[model samples]
Target: MAEGFLTTHVLDTARGIPAQGVKITLYRISGMSHRKIAEAVTNADGRTDAPILPKGTFRPGTYELVFHAGDYLRASGQAGDGVLFLDEVPIRFGMAEDTHYHVPLLLSPFGYSTYRGS
Candidate 1:
């Protein structure tokens, strides 16, 4: 059987560029427990150098991806030093054991969207 993996990317919708240097954290959620599984930072291409959840380590369960957007917004000049409207953005989802998941984020200063991609 083919094992699954998880990956993500960020795009700066307002600036029409790839969001670089964004911090990404992965968590495995079960019942009332949230356990951090992995962490990554987006490179210049708006993607991590490696998969957040590699194929061999994949499992079927609920997961969450936390994108630290406030820092990136400030550094990219999309936001000020003041408190941001959107700080840490969290997307909670479930995955099957045998499907590759590509979660892409289309982000702006005040709004963001995510979808399962190819």
Candidate 2:
């Protein structure tokens, strides 16, 4: 098996730019339990300086990426004073094989998208 790892990036679809300063949390979920495993904050390029789960640390299992987008939306002047429609976006997925998993977030004030990337 090839080395396995996990990474992520954030794109602001509405502004058409990288989303900086977005907080991300990784959770390892098993049955009814969710354990916090890692945390990262996006930099100027909307990417973590390092992989959230690096080689030798990554495993095939159920995971969740919680993107704190409300802070970014408010900081970018996109969110209104009322409650946000997309605040903490939780994307739950499974890594079935040992390879590379890039789960990116395409974010906007009202919605978001994510997928398995290269």
The reply for model 1, stretches above 4 Å from the true place, is none
Clashes of each: 0, 0
Q: In model 2, how large is the Cα lDDT of residue 79?
A: 88
Report the lDDT tens digits of candidate 2 across residue range 22-109: 9999999999999999999999999999999888887789999999999999999998778999999999999988998999999999
C-alpha lDDT of all candidate models, in order: 0.93, 0.94
TM-score of 1: 0.96
Q: What are the runs in model 2 whose C-alpha is more than 4 Å off?
A: none
TM-score of each: 0.96, 0.96
Instruction: For model 1, state the Cα shift of residue 114 in Å.
Output: 0.6
Q: lDDT tens string, model 1, 2-33?
A: 47999999999999999999999999999999
